[model samples]
Target: MSRIPQLVIANGTVVNSFGRRHAHIVVVDGKISQLVDATEPVPDAERTIDATGQLVIPGGVDGHCHVAQVTGRFRTLDDYRTTSTAALWGGTTTIIDFGIPRDARETPLEAVLSKKALAQESRCDVALHGSVVRWDETVPWQLEQLAAEGVRSVKMYTTNRGTTMADGDTILKVMREMVRLDGLTYIHAEHDPIIADCTAQHADDGRIGIEHLHRTRPELAEETSVKETLAMAQYTKAPVYFVHQSTPGAVDLVTEARARGQEAYSETCPHYLTLDDTVYGSAFPEWYACCPPMRSPETVAALKQRLAGGAIHTVASDHSCYDLTQKRERTDDVRAMPHGLPGVETRMPVTFTAMAEAGSSVEDFVEVFAAGPARINALPGKGSVAEGFDADLVLFDPSVQRTVDGGALHMGTDFSPFDGRTLAGWPAVVVSAGRVVLDREGFHDPGAVGRFVSRNGFREHLAATADLSAATL
Candidate 1:
């Protein structure tokens, strides 16, 4: 490893969500010390990287990554080391994971604390979101503990009953508490009744296979739940963020709420913007199995349109590390299969490709890929290439293209949903916290250098990043 106390990235275009400029970034002690003009004399440093002709953007902030996550009878294969290693490979220097309780017996406080302990194995920085499966007398105290631990957000689901769902009463109660705590509420919105009825019909008709996954979870179910959740957020006046929204209508609901001065945000995954329901008819439908499953091609197009128009706040991987064996275990029944895709390693190229296809600019992509997620999640030190920020930066070449091969990825998965797809904008060099991690030669093992980062309260965080929202909007 080429270790240096002071590193200079010279002669590159600094692309931030706010704007772009040609500058030489100086890194010292894991933070960006300065941004010198390209026209000025290059500052002397212990080592220098010639980033000439490269696009220097802030390292990506993947707000929805599941590392070694346990859900029901299944758990993802990758740990923090594997997941964060993959993140650095893909130019994501920071990742926020959910501390969802493993079961009803496991308290949310224990779940979050356990994840924090495990995060010491990460190769990159990490943050967490607390979760609640039900509203109990002790839940509010648990949430207060999470807030004190710097985990300012909590995630709840409107579906996945008996396993991870929270009733409407619980949801409303959590939102009200989040408001009181000055934190954000993270929700997985999907109308369980709509899904259960449709799925039951499908099962009775012998159509509950992987191929029928998308059909069972109708887009209207997602829309209905988004609206319902928005009502609760509005009543509680809590800043809310919806994860993995697959339909344009759901995104539009959040947009409308935001217009009404409600602090609402919609986050869509890369698979939702790229893959469609047609994959269900493919030879390997199990590869596409996920919650709030991929929508029709028309829906995918509309979601991309929503993204291009700035209605979406973040683009997350929703990365689950199940291999082909686990995926094949329940090929005949989507209900038993572990859902989610191995995507943290490919988020950069896939999102860059999708954004280009949406006719959006590079700066716009940075907003969703890095800035928006960091700000909304309260990780202010991440998602930008500027003075005094963490020296987490990536040098990318948008002109460079590669074909994705699932087996070649580093997310501890054996297949990729986007395998064989030619994508552009791969990262050439990655620096995390002033350390040279990935470059032309290869990855430098950083060990468990990633510590748990604390986040600010949502009210203060949003206020600080308002300029970012205004700039992108």
Candidate 2:
């Protein structure tokens, strides 16, 4: 026990999802040692930092990030190294990415394996969610292998039709398999028929451009799809998670299901929480061309209200990095454009601002920013600041602010969705795996590669250990 205290962070307010405490944090071998009371003697350590006025919080966990991800004709520009580094800068030490099959011929297991190999280049820890576009006799075996790989969640689309969508039969069969494996099922919920019909009508009227995106994908489609997916989840008793939920009605459906003893979760992105459909009318409409595009101002406000009410489980960046040129290339046709926004570096500030505007507390922000994602995703060592947890933590001023400049950021993109807006909650110092990765001086990469974290199964681990609702949100 000679190295019992290798590092010490003194005099900071340690914040948790449920509470906060003024304590000194001690670290040993990359895991938290303990939180020594201020009245107690400071534990001897090899290094110590005086964080007099900063808030020491668990490093952020971004559950929806796209790195070097391919979509249609274009691919996101950033790789594991770039995105993870940017995540550290933003106080997010752990990021969960999707292993979606590039084509129908590529097996789900193959996609997950490829992502794991690429994730080795990350400077921060990484986890993956596997995806399936179809169900064959071999899919059950592929899922078993995915669980063995620690990628426990599987994603499917209900709206992409021939390209990425899995029909109702495939979806139900996959949910049953996920339940058998004690894993979670993730759905991109948007009614396929509604979206297809709306897009066709827009095309007929010559209004299928990015500027008409919000109208093309209406909120009713999302609410309807959510209800359908929840029904399936309830029928199969499978734990289901809806990603990038953009409407309050959709979140309410999940909330009501949870009340009925169903395992359901709703995750909304920073874009849906802060930005509105007005971006479609702006000159740079292509910048907001993601599927299930930004909703109206009324919808945005209502979604924020849901988050404040604790109906939303997690707030993710949904970070997709495409340069301005790729976005410009397909501005004329929304269907052909690359979808997603560059916001990994801005998730902390943006979410903080949104919740603050909603009159929520820091404890609530802590819930969505770090704890909720870790708990729902079965990441045991990544979320809390308590003893034996990972020493991935950030020190920051809660009231400090900075205006965003997309070019000045590090996601390897040329623009930001929240450009020109001032935001708070920027990180001052970031520690990951017991190393001071970012501080006032600069970032210290030093050839550190992030580990691929294996997640725990729901029934095998979570149901036996914690409350489902508390663990999820």
Candidate 3:
């Protein structure tokens, strides 16, 4: 029989889906078995982590990331190994990244399997969200297959090269199919016609500054796309997730849609909450460029207010890093740069600082970073430190302060948009699935053992449906 490794983390404040509390956690067989008062004697175990004066919170679930995925004309730097390593160092234990199918030849299953092969050596748990590139008669069947393979979510773009830009009918069809399969459909909401026209107009006038990218893809573009997407969701009663919602106006739409009992939700990124369009005027404007480009300070303030007031469901990094050479190539016309920035490693610290500054409780942070993401993705036994849950935990030091340097970070990228900024509150220790992966000094000697979780609960529903379909035939 395999030995059940016993360990006790004592005198730490535990923060879970419920709230923060002072308790001692007992770990056995790589799972949390009990949480009791700190005054109790520390159980004899293989090891004891003395967490006095520290906060122990559930490890983050990064719901949106672009690890090893490629955008048009550019490829990402961090692959599965490097990206998950970086995430562990930053206190995230699980990631839900996009498995985008090749527009030319590959099927969704092939793409997802290929990515899984690449991620087999990861250091943190992983799951994939399939991106729908081609919407045809076979697309619904493909989605069902993906769900069977443990991918419970599918992504569709309203505007992207080589991806399907479905009309209202196609969108409705996809929504209905996804709903019937009991899978979540994530949409990249943006008006393609408006963006194309604005880009052409700016190209003609030679007004392609980094600042102008926002004007080209204005709030109206997002607003209109969100309206149309919600309409389709309403028509089909499909659960829709709006990715990287940036503006206050867009938040209002999502708020209203949720109120109407529609399963419409939105996610915002760290870049939108911190950086704004003015950053584009800096000496290295390309460093701040990203899709759904940064907006005004007013919008940022409104987003903060909305997030604090519980309007926003979750926050993600949306991290996509390219080499510095790729970013600098578009120095002349900011539109030429690859649209993304590095944040997977910085997301936790930055958000923690922001929440502290806003006087928001730690419970609120746990909801957005842990519970909400895991629940939305239907990840079982994750997002908490209760009994029988995986021991994915982070020991945080609220007093420690540090400065962010893009060049010094572990990401494969060569730059960071938040370089030189000091942030309070940092993760002192990170544990994933009962193994200690990172500490204050950096990564430890534990070998990479992360595995792809075949989601059991929600994904099982898809398999059951497939069986029923065959039986009916």
Candidate 4:
């Protein structure tokens, strides 16, 4: 019998959501076989990495991102190859992107299969949250099948109108069905009426500037939708996660619901936590245009405080990369401009630098960015440094500092939202499944060995408290 291949990462401060200690991680067949003390002499088979003064933590799990997604007329700039490479360079070993149907004619299963085909060349692990575009009697069965196939979550929109938004009753029905199927719901919560009314007023007044984009979709719009969805989630007994929460009020709602022992978790992105609406007044405001626009600085500050206090559960990138040419063409009308920013490469460093400056520790970083997201997304073998977990790790050097430059990044976009910002704590080495994908020289594409993770399903803690009586009437 051939001996199992082994690799050891030695002399690093292994950190997790709970704590950190000096340990040597042993990897056998791409799985963590042991976490021994650094002082102990271990038998190493293949290779060893010297992580003398670095912090070793679980690789990032970006639970919300858009790569190769087709939106209206234009497709996203980054596909699996570029997006996954950027993810690895940024210490993200796993990403959960949306699998959206191209049109009404396509079934959810077909959408998922197409997305998986696109992800076949990914340089890092990729999973998908199937989008439910066509809701009918057959929808529940499809959702259950998708869940069983490792797509444990589905995304629903409430503001895109004829494109992807589902009505209130439709959402409620879907939530109820999700409850029965053991599938989780990820919602882009924004009241369509509010946004539409505001947009109509702006158009009537000929105020279609980027500033109007912020005015049309104010914090109240998000708050109203968030509160309403929480109620539906509470009544339907389904676990709902709000994505890209930008307002303090919405975060408060999630916190309050959890206080009531409800099943809810709020996810905020790096852009929302750090950037303010002030960017709308910049020379090129179209570049910063995204749905649920950045909130007031005061709200941003409050969100940071809440994040530190554990009110905010997870921080994701929501990375939707669009080229500068795409954004520039619609500069005359903000509504026509593509929404999103290239963030997969900058997500971890930017957020890490901000929270670290706010006095957050390494453990807090792991909890929110890695472990918490992994747990929420149902990736059992991710987000921790321990035996029996995947050897997906990052060796971070906190002393190194670098300024952000979009042109220098590996992302497909030409500009960075974080340009000129200096950040520390960059991952000097990113190891995915025991293979080194990023090192001192640069990123290396280790072929397409990334696997689709079949998630273990929702956290039973919330399911145990679900109100089954709230099922569809």
Q: Write the per-residue lDDT of candidate 1 for residues 19-67, one digit (tens) a residue.
A: 9999999999999988999999888889899999899999999999998
lDDT of 4 by residue, 315-392 (tens): 999999898999888766776778888898888898898888778888898888888888888776788887778999
Return the lDDT, model 2, position 191: 98
Q: Work out the TM-score per prediction.
A: 0.97, 0.97, 0.93, 0.95
Q: Alpha carbon lDDT of residue 352, candidate 2?
A: 91
Task: Output the lDDT of residue 430, model 1.
Answer: 95
Put down candidate 2 lDDT per residue, 1-473, tens digits, no spaces.
Answer: 35557789998988888788888999988899789986677788888987878999999999999889987778899999999999998999999999999887789999989989998899999999999999899999999999998989999999987778999998999999999998999999999999999999999999988899999999999999999999999999999999999999999999999999999999999999988999999989987888789998999999999999999999999899998999999788888888889889899999999999999998899989998899889897877888878999999998899999888999999999999999989999999999998888988883546989999997666653365336534
Compute the lDDT of residue 356 as modeled in candidate 1: 98
For model 1, the superposed segments whose C-alpha errors exceed 4 Å read 1-5, 467-473
The candidates, ranked best first by lDDT, are 1, 2, 4, 3
Q: What are the lDDT figures for the candidates, one per model?
A: 0.92, 0.90, 0.81, 0.85
Clashing pairs in 4: none
Off by over 4 Å in 4: 1-5, 460-473
TM-score pick, better of 2 and 3: 2
